[model samples]
Target: MTSDTLAPAKPAVDLEGITKRFPGVVANHDIRITVAAGTVHAIVGENGAGKSTLMKILYGMQKPDEGTIKVNGEEVSFRTPSDAIDVGIGMVHQHFMLADNFTVLENIVLGAEPKKGANLDTGAARARITELGESHGLRVDPDRLVEELGVGDRQRVEILKVLYRGARILILDEPTAVLVPQEVDELFDNLRELKADGLTVIFISHKLDEVLNIADEITVIRRGTTVTSVPRSAVTDARQLAEMMVGSELPTPETRESTVTDRVMLDVKGLTLSGGDGGRPLLSDVTFPVHAGEVVGIAGVEGNGQSELIEAIMGMRALNGGAIHLGEEDITSWATLKRREAGIGYIPEDRHRQGLLLQASLWENRVLGHQTRPPASKGIWINRKASRADTERIVKEYDVRTPSVETLALALSGGNQQKLIVGREMSGEPVFLIAAHPTRGVDVGAQAAIWDHLRNARAAGLAVLLISADLDELIGLSDTLYVILRGRLVARLDPSDVTPDRLGGYMTGAITEET
Candidate 1:
């Protein structure tokens, strides 16, 4: 054998002394990462720890202020995403980007459609998509509309979209953030297939367990720098990895003592809503009550009317039938603003859509829902000083990692944004809080802090309706739990008695109330 055959091959991706800086923050500094060819390389970090920034530099979304990037042992500079793509790199963002009205094939071949004369050669594109799907175990029908596909299938389409562009290396940013347990398993399977086919995957995630389970090598980044990079064998457990990422022990959501009270604070009776195509009701006869100093968690698969139930309670959606009462007063007829003023706090699931104005500063966002109230406003005149001061307080209290209160909401990391929202809602002295996926994309540290806040609020006699896809969070934080399936409250589970596996079965409709 030759000397070259005996030596190991170079990494698919190598970054040396990479540094990135913003106005008042050093996003990354002297970061080094190496991904062995055809292996799953996981990047684990807390929110605002520069994981995404490094990935952006790698994918050409942002250029590093210093250092070098090497692809397959060859130095390269990527000025744009297209430049990275040209060097066989592709990135799947945390959010799925697809035209809702377009077909799968159309979406896949959108910017790079094959041309035959003046017309688009969709047939050739479809054939290639089919071949890619079969070869990579990413099976999907090209004729299906993007809107009609499920989340897992949509993710597959995204992977196929990049594969169609001839990418040898893939960067997945929080790919399983929105997927359920089963869907996540399937996604891992798909990833394994990609790895088997000699494609390198750079995975970035806050979920340490998933990272440990799927990754060949794990890189821990903290405070805008790489802490350590180790093979899977070097790390013993997710707890160790989390501690490395956060530089401390992991926090748990488990409540010590039951703070649930007998006084019912929020009451919903016979809640019903019309479904799509006028078939089944979206929320059917959903009746539940959250007592003062209690967290009533709703556990269900995503899209099984969790959003509708929260919206109905918030008065954002009109109910066909049902009575909602806060304390003793009927609030079913109230508008969204009225509900807000009535001490019903809302932390929306999609933060960007219902929570904050990206263009506005953090202080401005703090005054959003509480605009007409005292502190944020005085008789319709904005209290800018009060808002700014209060925002600074929230930033300090909630541990929102930001340079200043004047920073734009868009500048903060997802977890920090979530923390700010949590602080804002809790600051309003709400009688009943509808916290929907409050810690969805937050890091473990932030999640623990948010849980601590919720626990503290519960101790102080706050009623909460917690909706989350994380089974552990629901089981740990909730005093009482209800399982919703196909828009109905299918099972009332005791949080102490249920396991995540059992909960998963109920969420997927595999296990019924009778069982």
Candidate 2:
């Protein structure tokens, strides 16, 4: 055997004493981690715990103030992401960076297209992508537009993009945040195949169960430092990992006995929304009633008009034909601000896009949805004192880890941003709330806290429409569950008895209404 084949496996990456400092945030301090080659190393931490910062340092997006980075047993310093890529490191961000107008093959080969005498080598690129997809179990059409693909396909294309760039090590940030149960399983399968092919994978997520499932080693970062790194065999369950990250008991997402009442708080009747440019209807006769103190859950694969439904209810979308009733008053003709004024609260799906202005201060974002109401505004004037005070209250009550209320929303972690959104939407004591993926990117602790808040609100006679991709959360927190497929309600399931698999079957159209 050759000397290279005979030697022991080298550590794919070694980060020692990684310290990165922002103005008010010590993002990472004395962080250390090691990933064995050809193994899946999972990193877990609370929001604002500095996990993302450490990953950025490793991926060369941010330079560490004081640290040593070693790749493949050789010391290296990366001044830019291209430098990291040159040494076989690639990163896939939580938010996709693909162009919607481009095809999959075009996106994969955008920056590093193979050359043929000053011309792009399209055939070679397609062949290589096809080969990679076949080997990695990430099959997708090369000619399909990114906008025309599903969430899972987009994720697969992202993985392929990394592999096509000759990267042997992959860094995935919150890869499964938007995937349904089945899609997560498929992604895990692809990851395992990649591991089998001797590629190193760095997986960062707040989902401990998934970490335990796929990780060969688990590293926990707490409060800007590495708390512990252990083999998968060392930890038994998610509770152990959760406690290590939060220094407290892991909170469960189960709700109490039915707080549901007979009074209908918000009622939708024959809601229909036409697609832009005379396409098919986005929402077709979607009707449901959320009673006071009841939590009505909506479950569906993404891009199936859930956003349209929420927008219609929030008055952001103009409905073709429908009547929305809030406690016996037809509000379909009301404007968006009027809906907000009438006690209808909304927590949108994309926090960065629809929830908060990232460039604004936390207290400023607190004044967003309630800009016209108390503690935020007073007769054409912004009430800064009351707004700042209430923002601080939310920071304390919701356990948002930040230095001060004046900090910009962009500086906070995704989970912290999500926490702020939940706190803002739950404020103003709205009689009805629309919570879409309330705990999407939060850690177990934060997720539990949000669930507790929602449960408390439900008990206080606030009607809620809960939407989520986490099946356990959807099934556990919802008293009544409705599945929307292709803009229509396909199944009304009993959450008490349905399993994730069965619900996923309904979501993917594998199970018909008759079945």
Candidate 3:
């Protein structure tokens, strides 16, 4: 063989000495990583450790202050996401971007539509999308509306959307954050297929178990810098990787103590809501009582009335028939604001929609749920000084990583934003808390801290209604667990008596009460 034939090939991606800085936070500092061609490269880090910032730089959402990025051994600079797309780099964000009114094909070929004399060439787009989906293990109906798809199906559409845009490299941020166990397995299988087809994937996630299971190589980042990069085979267990990222072994969500009291804090009786679908109700005959010092968990697949149930309890949605009470006060006729004042804390599933104002500063967001009361307000007047001081307290108590209380909500990482929301909701000593996916995108370290807070709150006689997609979390922290399927309670499981797989079966309706 010739000497030239024996030379090694160039890496698919090489980021060297990359540095990024904000006003007071060093988002990234001298970061370095190299990914081999056609391999699955995983990035693991804590919430505010600068994982998102590095990915933003890679995807051209932000530019680095120093260092270089090389693709296939050739140096390149990206001024915008469009410039990054031109070089075959596509990014799938944790929060998906798609129009609910658009069909699958329309969303897939939206910005880059092929035209047939001033009209959209949808036929060609549909054919290409179908082919890409089938070949990549991501089959979906192109004619289906985006609103009709489930969470997993929606994720598949997102992956397919990037694949159809001629991307050779894909960056997925927290892709499995909302998926159930089976859906996660399916997503991993699809990723394996993509890797087999000679496409490179850069995965960013805080799930160490999933990272170890899927990644060919894993890079750990801590405090805005790369700690180490090692092959999956070289590592023995998730503990090593967890320690590398957070300087500790993975924290369990398990709660063994029983802090339940006899006092009923939140009572929902015969809760019913019309879905506007002929005769079907969105939430049907849901009756439950949460006691003081107890954690009652609701588990179900996405879009199976979990969100609607929360809305009903929080008085955001008008119930066709139901009665809600907080410690025997019939709040069935109360408004959302009235419920808030009645000591019902809410941690919404979609933080951006119901939690915080992204454009507002941290101190301003502190007044979101508790506005018009005490620290956030003073006798129907806004208390900016009190808000700022209390925001500082929450930032310190909740370990929210931020440069200043004046920082905008959009400037923090998803996990930090979640932490801030958690702190805000737990304030004012609310008697009842409705926590929906509280740790959805948070890292393991932050998740542990949040769990600790929940435990402490429960011990202090707080009643909680916890709704989550994570089976382990539900089974671990719940004193009482109820399975919801098609807007009805299917089973009430003992958290300590069930496994994640078994809990998942009930959540997905595969295991019924009859079975």
Candidate 4:
């Protein structure tokens, strides 16, 4: 089946004059979009740009305050996701909704489980899931528990789940955010195959390059309004798309003089951590030094002991073997708080899981890393006014879009949340900063701003250990890049000497030869 065959004869989904409002916010105003059948329609915008809100309305996750939705020219309304699914629409959220302990087949057919003789029909569901995977070239292990699967495989399971439910229009939100380069390539291939098989895909992404590469038409959203929709051929380049997204020409970071000080701010020597099986260490003899005024980037596929390495460094997990030193002091045995107090600023990879309390107000989240900072506290009494003032400063400086510092962190857009987190981490002025995927899910404007901030921090003589799945980001920002494969530092490259393709080859363990 070709995409041509799969797409409806006309527009598969259409929205006109959509409007949604929240307390003190107009989430979406006079939005209009038309997604044709069998074409990859991309929605690009900064965080809190109302793209997600519009998608939610389409998927029936939320009812629009005013608008009309049409499926194949027929007006429709969806009060719940089930209603959308019933009309052949399925949405894959940024966060996977699979139960870790459940088998892939179980997760796929969860709410609509087949029944045989008053019991759940596991056999039929497994057979159906296998058929769907084979038909779509998805290649998933239906019996494998989600917890045992890699992130890429887990994403595949999510896609298969939607396909199994007979969805004709597939919506993917930031599908490549967590994927490595190879995985991203594979996903694009799979998406192309799906399109060829006649499925309409509405792809939401912050990465303009990917959108231009895959989309037939592109829709750019700014703030809470629809800026314009244009053919893929019209935009010409990422710069044009970026201009539309931010309504401004962004400045490129200039190559700076090597201001790296000879003194080592952070040193890791022969660091090793036992794997889950407790045999060979997951991190084997990893050693590196972070010097002041330099950004050292670790580029690796996910689960190559990067998480373990960060955990060990932060003192959240014990090290099986190795030593970590901050300046001249050994901190391998110190508590996480003590390490932080000793001048370590850590922005964890999983922001929702480890970084912020979603339900807490912005001020509370802002003061998290610096509860002991002067003015935030005195002896045992917490100073609310001082914390609010500090948060307001960050909000104003970082351009965080919030009505007040008392707004729940969860209510902010992904980009704004990231800005707040970055601001909080940088505010401490730590000697060493550990930033993992700091720009993930953020728009181009915010990404440029973040790069500028990191450069300024480096200029101020802060040593940075940056970890990211974004190969371009790793190459663009890092002075030196290290690639890890299966818990080993496989190759190190000067950023100027290596391309993203070469870096990806090293990251995927396809290239073992040292550069």
Candidate 5:
């Protein structure tokens, strides 16, 4: 069927000339969009392209400087998120706003608790939540604690929250970012079911493939303006969408010509890390070796000791057993800073928490790792001039989009922030690199750039331990792959023979055969 035939009889949300401005930047400029009911509209853009700002305006989190919003063809203004909720509009933020200690039912009914006879009617709330989840295909346990659930399960709880509030239009920001491939497929299936039942979904994502697969229409935003809004059938493929997002052809990486070296650079011998609360080992007997000019990828569903593995390598977490050897030296007892000085560079999984200081300036963050070293600081006094120059060089080299080095790290987009972190970590010319979820929230364009950079680093005789939840990315980048299931190495494969589906099966503990 044609898009027009499939579209709702009436537009669900019509935004005209939506303009929002921050102190020094015009975030959204004269943008116009129309999302029809019972349809999935995908918004695609580069980091810092103002897609988030536009969605915030729609969700009543931010006020527009100039705009007109029509819900069901009726112009209305929303003073708060509650006002938007009253009109059947709900937003699921990228970072889940859930209380870890609270039960799922409590979290879903937090703001608007059910009451009967001057007492909290939790039983009725739980029943309603269960019904909403079952009817909408978003299965969730209302009594489970948030801290005990996986990332995908937490997202389901968020969706149930909105459904319980009787929302017809749902806004999901990067919903599938933390999910595995299978979980992503299940989410898409649920979304299709919701659309079939006459629910309007606004899906914001950087992954073009998911957008093309799920969205009826796609909108491209560039530099705080709507570049184009076209039906999905009109666009040829992801390459075209990527070009539109970045506004240029991305640089391709040079193919590796050097033969893989046989010299081992780092080795892990039965490494084990105990969980904090007297639990079992987060990483149990995980052994791997990385050679020069090689990339060894660790692929698995997240929280299966990926974070613990990286932390053990960096010496941030205590190892319960075994040792880590860098070349010929035993460095298991070394401090994190000592490991860094001994030719180890690490890109952490959570950029906001472990990599960049959001409130600090870009230049300050750039030189944070090198503050006590030469060129950045001499003893206690920092060399701001040298640091700014270095920051500028890193920004240009990494294609980081920022107005100035003096800008706060939080002001930059997610992709740019990640680029800055990667650039800083890789700038020291370390012999070994440990990258954990390096490209989690990056766009395709940036993802390509990062892969090229890592490949180049590998080609230059650096040993890389790449950990990721994206199986496709892992297969594409690594020469060898290993699977981790419940803190144990379950299988290994050569990248040439492994498929994403097979890897996904192993990652979720469905299949355990080695190829």
Candidate 6:
């Protein structure tokens, strides 16, 4: 026999004819994928392209209507998450599933605690955890509370949780979504370590650059089916993979010509938020100006006063001391509704929490923020017919894919929900916009579309205060950029002069502002 015949014939994972369906939607259709052992395999797709559905099926969170799954060359069926885990497969979710009050050890050993004579074997578990940490390069103090950990450390804990359960095949979903550039590098390093230790990883991400950098094999999913799978050597870069995923060249956020005007639309001076109980101030003398037809982007690690600044600007939170001006009008003491009525549009960070009513119909949600304006309301009554008509316009113009306007917002994908919110916020032609993580959890196409909308609005003299964790987005879309450190605006720079790597230095306080 030849060497090929003597070699192993089966892959680490094999899925054939995988199919799943929901009401009026075929989430996955005849999907097929093969992953090699001891390598990083990446899955890339658009927001609504059925990637999550497929992952759910594989993890046993959802049952496939039709398919054959093979792990380690043995055909298997998983009816629950435990079944998958028993087969050596473990999944780390996109949204973390951990109690803040729990210690790291408790969170990891909650379901699978070692027992010794009717007592939980805490000593044995700690020893095992310590060993695993050293072996996998995923070290964390076992006694640290989950709440006290940073984003990167929390992620390490999640990885350890899965590894603690004896998982050899790991699935990580959007693993670096909330991480800064430095954290992303560390994550990649950890992934490399996993690969070195004879482990298989299936990484799902929307970040093409990171995927290209780390993935050994790539699979593209579109709509509800597999488009293609290529080895890393076959593909050149992120742009190529993006075109394969969305069937076009990835859109750029670069603005060739400046649209900034001297007309100042948003001005803040001496913005401060006191820390109760006489601690440090949450916002310290924050000051900035967004002129008409300009996009002023803020770059920071999450929780560094970006959210507070946005809320303060929208009048959703009280400031300790400051003045907010909109077109020369001081709106310091205005209520949230008054700010909206005065032409302030807000795209909140959490769409499900602040942007849409999940149980309500799409048409109903279209009137959410614009309830007092025309096309959504007439006099004291909601114009349901007009609102539905306008919803149709938004769905078409914004490329929101859905069956009908009567569908509940909960049934729509996250990207579609975000598109609806963007449409609603852009309706009244607000003079100033606060877009916080506007493109979070969205695919490349949706991101490009939103960036286009912002650019078009900027051209029409709309000022935008853009806050995003995406350094490239901030650098490409902003005329000016601010770096926030511990609730203070520490550095200001022209967007043209900064790179993402350089901006990451400012964000992490590794590089100080040069006076």
Q: Per-candidate TM vs. native?
A: 0.95, 0.97, 0.97, 0.94, 0.93, 0.94
User: How much lDDT does each candidate structure score?
Assistant: 0.91, 0.91, 0.92, 0.87, 0.86, 0.90
lDDT for model 3, on a 0 to 1 scale?
0.92
lDDT of 2: 0.91
Error of 3 at 293 (Å): 1.2
Candidate 1 residue-wise lDDT at 419: 96
Q: How many backbone clashes does candidate 4 have?
A: 3
* Candidate 1 vs 6: which has more lDDT: 1
Q: What lDDT does candidate 2 reach at residue 44?
A: 93
Q: Between 1 and 5, whose TM-score is larger?
A: 1
Clashing pairs in 2: none
Model 1: per-residue lDDT, tens digit, 162-269?
Answer: 999999999999998777778888999999999999999999887788998899999988999989999999999888988888877777789879998999999999
- Model 1: clashing residue pairs? none
- Give the TM-score comparing model 6 with the true structure, all chains together: 0.94
Query: How much does candidate 5 score in TM-score?
Result: 0.93
- Model 6 has an lDDT value of 0.90
Instruction: Name the candidate, 1 or 4, with the larger lDDT value.
Output: 1
Q: What digit string (tens of lDDT, one per residue) describes model 4 on residues 370-394?
A: 7786556767767899889999999
Model 3, 229: alpha-carbon shift in Å? 0.7
Off by over 4 Å in 1: 1-7
Q: Which pairs clash (backbone N, Cα, C closer than 3 Å) in model 5?
A: none
Q: lDDT tens digits, residues 1-515, model 2?
A: 88977978779999989999998989999989999999999999988899888888888888999989999999999889999999999999988999999999999999999999999999999999999999989899999999889889999999999999989999999998878889999999999999999999999988889999999999999989999999999998988888899987777778859999999999999999988788878898888899999999999988888999999999888899989999988999999888888999888899999989999999999999899999899889999999999999999999988899999999999899999888988887799999999998788889889999999999999999998888888899998999988888888888898998899999989987731
lDDT of 1 at 368: 86
C-alpha lDDT (0 to 100) for residue 72 of candidate 5: 88
- Please report how far candidate 1 places residue 357 from its true position, in Å: 1.3
